[model samples]
Target: MIADTELILNADGSIYHLNLKPEDLAHTIILVGDPERVPIVSKYFDTIEVRKGKREFITHTGMLRGKRLSVLSTGIGTDNIDIVLNEIDALINVDFTTKVLREDLRSVDIIRIGTSGSIQGNIPVGTLLASEFAVGFDTLMQFYVKSYTAAEQKLAEAVNRHFSNLSFSPYIGSANPALLKQFAMELPKGITMTAPGFYGPQGRSVRTHNMYPDLIQKANSFITKEGLYITNLEMETAGIYALSNMFGHRALSINAILASRLHEEFCANPAEVIDSAIQYVLNRI
Candidate 1:
């Protein structure tokens, strides 16, 4: 039996952070980093049936092309990803009334549509990319007991050896192969580096000094034995992939490239790029 302290729930029997019950969730979920983007993804729905939110988490469930789907926001970073993914897994797999795990466990398809910066100069602004794998600079995955596959282990070793000057070890997580094959056939795909913050963690300096000034150069030059490169930088993909694996759910991160870290360029029309990326995923999903 799970303790109340461990699996906390609201008085309304909805999952604590997400404020959603099992019925309120759909089998396919779209995760966005911004709360306002929740409605942007759902606006194309045939009919929106549920709308719920708490803090930065907002959810909308509706139908599109006779398929039921839901869009939820996780704000930013792996910390928020931890809360949103766990609460969502509990909503589908645990009985809130009984405070126990359900006999018949369920799995959901999680798709992340978010903006990111291209670490490779070849991948220019306004390009849409898919995260085949993510290298987490954050420590979120350390708390969870996970076994890395042979390929994942090899990739992690490469990243660690390349960034040996860094203080902490990085971890690797991957997208669901089934989802990758389904949606990434026509898109450019590569490894994404998930940073803990937008500024210093991602090697940006304002007033404060950056610890690893050559971080972007090292990342851009990193190549795997399999010949893959670290292509983009973002806040959530690694944690999303990690927890989705832990929960037995299918997860994919589709990124809209609005900036190029390698070339120091930002897209002028960010909204148009985001809207197009949203429509692209919607049409395929």
Candidate 2:
């Protein structure tokens, strides 16, 4: 049994950060980065069952075409994902009343529908990019033991070799194949690089000077030994993939490209593009 300090709960017995109970969630979950986007996804539901929010976390559970699904917002970045994933796992796999794990574990499908900037020129703005693999620029997974797969290790080595001058090591993670085949078979597939932040981590500079001036160009040109290139840059997929894999959950990230770094083009109507992608995912999943 775990201590209360380890997994703090509210007075009503809801999870500390998410404020979600086991009954509030569904087996199929659509994760968004923006809290406001929660209702945007849930709007397509036939009947809304639950609507809950706390901090940047907002959850809406309902039925979509007769399938029970839950859409929850995780705000942004790997740090938030660290909290969301672990809490969701605990809600289903652990008995909060006794602070003990259940005899039988439950795994859920986590599909992240978020926006990203394309590093590759061919992938234009408004495009929907399905992450076949996610490369983490952050050190989230490094804190966990044996978090990467054999394929990921090989890809990580190649990525490190390409950006050898960088001080930190990057990790690679693959999306669940079953989920990918089910939801993203016809979509444009590529390796997504998840940055730690919106600015310098993604090679964006305002008043501050960038450590790697040619970071975006190098990332765009990076081709693995197997000839796979990095497609886009986002903030959450790698952590989602790694943590989901560790917890036995099926994870996939579907990105709506809002900007093209190589072409220097940004979507004129990003809302429409995101809505279209959300509708597309709803139709499939």
Candidate 3:
């Protein structure tokens, strides 16, 4: 049987697929998708310490405004998320580094600051969108559970029939209100759509063309009776919300709206938006 942890690399602890260890992180963490962005975030740090990596998973732990935090890259998709979330939880919750369980492990605050395109016109470029909720069109959760909640099922039924969506179904998801609310003053709040990919998954055109030409339009028009909106499109927010919630971590996604294909415009300078989010979170957290 596969166990929770098996020491392999350093021999003193479990070496996750990412190869990160207990000492490699801080309680306040920021996760980006690109390894290059790791240092971009770390540049705001007050002091530098541990730096480790394997493949696209690059890690750097440092102090920002006297607050120690770690910034790491997950490469892409829910697959990498599955690996990072579980092992990070283990590092703090389990006692594999020792022989006893460390139930009192410090809870890490995880915030994903990344770039995404706005599905709607109102959510324009050069703004930071803090995702209050994420709607997943990915099947990562399917391996864990066979059924969806009533609301999730309802969302699926609605979106599926409208767009003839398949291969993956929609799942309603949310982040920790406390965590999201903490940075409320800094970023624009919205309901983000977590699409599986940039091409067919998000209604993008290639030489072969998109099967659902109106899917993006349909998405821009969607809303629940509760007045929730899907304002932005991204790859990782849904997985982040679902896994982080399940594992008892407060998580949020701050997406820089760099492009709105509907308007055919770009952010002009998206790095400014990213800087805003990084500075805001660094201060608030």
RMSD of 1: 0.8
Model 1 TM-score, all chains together: 0.98
The collision pairs in model 3 are: 46-63
Candidate 2, residue 236: Cα displacement in angstroms equals: 0.3
In the range 115-151, model 1's lDDT, one tens digit per residue, is 9999997999999999999999999998999888787
lDDT of 2 by residue, 1-285 (tens): 989999999999999999998899999999999999998899899999999989999999999888999999999899999999999999889898999999999999999999999999899899998999999999998889755678988898999999998899998889999999999889999999999999999998999999998999999899876779999999999999999999999999999999999888999999999999899889987
Candidate no. 2 TM-score: 0.98
The number of residue pairs in model 3 that clash at the backbone is: 1
TM-score of 3: 0.88
Candidate 2 lDDT for residue 274: 98
> What are the lDDT figures for the candidates, one per model?
0.94, 0.93, 0.77
Report per-prediction Cα RMSD to one decimal: 0.8, 0.9, 2.8
Comparing candidate 2 with candidate 3, which one achieves the higher lDDT?
A: 2
Error of 3 at 196 (Å): 1.4
Candidate 1 backbone overlaps, count:
0
Off by over 4 Å in 3: 1-14, 97-106, 146-167
lDDT of 2: 0.93
